[model samples]
Target: MQDRTLIFVLLLGLLVCGAVSLTVGSPLPAADLLLAAMGEGDPRHRLILLEIRLPRVLLAVLVGWALGLGGAALQALLRNPLAEPGLIGVSASAGLGAVIALYFGLAGVWALAPAASSLTGAGLATALLLTLTRRGDTLSVILSGIALSSLAVALTSLAMALAPNPYALSEMVLWLMGSLKDRSLHDAATAAPLIACGSLLILTAPRGLRALTLGEDTATTLGIRLPALYLRVVGGTAAMIGGAVTVAGSIGFVGLLVPHLLRPLTGHDPARLLLPSALGGALLVCAADLAVRLLPTPQELMVGVITALIGAPFFLLLLLRRHLREALP
Candidate 1:
């Protein structure tokens, strides 16, 4: 199928999933509440639809879009199919930043503290990555990212270990697991600007990435300005991943899985994959969020957990299939 056709289909799927998300939740006939909310006639319906569901749906769409785009951009820039948005270590740092906020009881008093602090964390982590990767090689990025993740994870664990109270610890743990439930419009608003900036930064690098598939030296020979390309892609990834974790906690797999799924359809060209990957990611997260609401579980499952559950097995299958093909030859 043509890239435009595939993207059109994904957009339609996203719309269908979004409609189901807005209309499928509790008290049944949320479609009525949706209409009432739009009509502005019923305060209670307005509260439920406007306050509860709309923001969650928006954040789901935005976060998914950011992750998917960031993932494809990172993979293309690094010339590594295995690379993901979090490979820059911003997500871990952002989560740690949120934990620090909750530990200090700031989130209790201020609704935006976690988001603010997490964005700061993401910025700091990105700065650290740039400092370490001044030479702008892919290996340096991978290594710096590993070091940053380890340090952030260690600090997060220490904070949990030294939590002043069980409530703080529980909150930290739950937030780390990630979810889109109970998010507010303010959270959605906060994430949108940064996600936009990051996405725009990433979108600029696809031509470079396409050139890169020829090899870094060849790309450089083509006047791709390797250092500037790295700067743009990394900075953009940090912003998007940071923004995503701020609102959704730590949802995973949308970045890694969506691109791989869409790659073959896009003929595996980095430039060709971006739009479809972004659309597919949004559709995946929106549908997953809706599924969590509909499932007959004790509690609404964390969407992050749901993605991890699906993605880990998918990764294993990917490896096994690759291995089997090699063995067959």
Candidate 2:
């Protein structure tokens, strides 16, 4: 499909999925839900649609967009198709930060504390990675990312293990598993600025990324400042991934999957992949959340679980295909 056509289709899917999300779990008809959202229907239905559902839908879209865009930017920067926000440890560290806030009871008192903490954690991880890999070789960066992610994961596990009570442990586990249930407009509002800013930052790097495709020396020859490009990508990834983890916990693979899925449609141009990936991510998350709501289980499945179920198999298939191609010779 043409890039423009694919993007339009993804946007249409996002809108349709978002609409379905708002009305999916409610017993009221779609028309009634729409009326309630506009404040002209039953009060209970109105509360369900507006107070409960709309914010969740919005959060899903925002978080998914950030992850997808951040992933694409990172992949472009690293020139690694497998690179993602989580692979660099930012998401794990951000989750740890939020967990610390929750464990210390800070999140209960300050509406923004969790997100702030998450951002700090993500920033620190990026800083450490940049410091250790001063030469910025692709292999060095990836290795450092792996080490940082491992450390973050270990710390998070330790925190869970030492939780003061079962309730705390359960809360941490559920949060890590990821869900959009019970999120409010306040959560969405708090995350919006960070996500928006991060997206703008990432969007600014496409020219540099496109240039770098020819190599750092070539990009420098083209007047792209490598230092500034690195900073922009790191800062943008931190903000986007941190905000996303804060809002929805460590929901995985939207970043890894969305860009990969849409890259071909964008003619394999990293610059062209950003917007379509964002829209596709939003559409996927919204649809997944709706599916979780509609499932027959006594408790709704976590959105993360659904994404994992989908992404894990796809990842294995990707590996298998690569191995087969490599073995073909």
Candidate 3:
């Protein structure tokens, strides 16, 4: 009952923030003007409400939700709070795929070029990660992820360095920074189904995830099929994180922070954290998007930049606490 109340309040807060984001921007539309625009909106006003603002807001919410859920699941499965989709080369590999497609002129092959390449790359990286760490130690898995991420980033840099077209280089740089600017309905549509399906898969695996709370040997003793469960978790994570990066270009740290913020409410139970973490993540990102628009700045910061700024300090705090704990007798 308490959990439901907390989730309801968080979700309601997110909805309110989202509505406020729609109403406020440069020149800051009046409340009456905003309502009038919504009622009998002119093309210009409607375009601002729908195309310019709404897509940015929605994409932020969706990406944050996906990352938060995926991160919580990964941490639960690995029993490591540091486990995150981006930490494991997922986002880097997806960025590499997108950069390659753009560099090769394949990004213009169709409307789906970027999405297809990103999904493919994420899938490959995930497969490599699983293979390298199959029944291996946690430290080994983390090392493998770091190696893969380094390789992907290096390749992405090489591609950008060698690109013959300045336009392609410009696009690649913008993408690596991660932004939700000027996204269209097509981008949203392509990613939505994948995120939905991935989220469903993660949510459905609660039983298996809970089983994993026991040691692997004990889980096996209890008749859980480790291989199948791992496949489902990895595949679902790839789909959502890959599709998200495809559209939004590597937004960072929502995965890392959202779960931490909501875990207190979940009593540290991975099962209970999933839905609440997703909601909290959506709210955080939507609130950040609102801040980006409301801030008095000449240039708009990417949503990713805002998250990293907020998250970096939190990450450092966690590291400090952990260090202190380890140092204590």
> Using lDDT as the measure, which candidate wins?
1
User: Taking the tens digit of each residue's C-alpha lDDT, what string does model 3 give over 245-299?
Assistant: 9888887888888887777778888888888888887888788777776777899
Candidate 3, which ten residues in sequence have the lowest lDDT sum?
Answer: 28-37
Per-residue lDDT of candidate 1, residues 97-158 (tens digit): 99999899998899888888888998899999878877778999999998999899899999
- Cα distance off (Å), candidate 3, residue 262: 1.6
lDDT value, residue 288 of candidate 3: 75
Kindly report which residue stretches of model 1 are placed more than 4 angstroms away from their true locations once superposed.
27-31
Cα misplacement distance, residue 312 of candidate 2 (Å)? 1.4
Q: Where does candidate 3 stray beyond 4 Å?
A: 26-40, 105-112, 127-144, 318-329
Model 3's TM-score against the true structure: 0.87
- Check candidate 1 and list the clashing pairs: none
| True-structure lDDT of candidate 1 | 0.88
Which tens-of-lDDT digit does each residue in 118-155 have in candidate 2? Answer: 77887788778767666645676678878988998899
Best by TM-score: 1
| lDDT for predicted candidate 2 compared with the true structure | 0.84
TM-scores, one per candidate: 0.96, 0.91, 0.87
After superposition of all CA atoms, the RMSD between model 3 and the true structure is 3.1
Question: Which wins on TM-score, candidate 1 or candidate 2?
Answer: 1
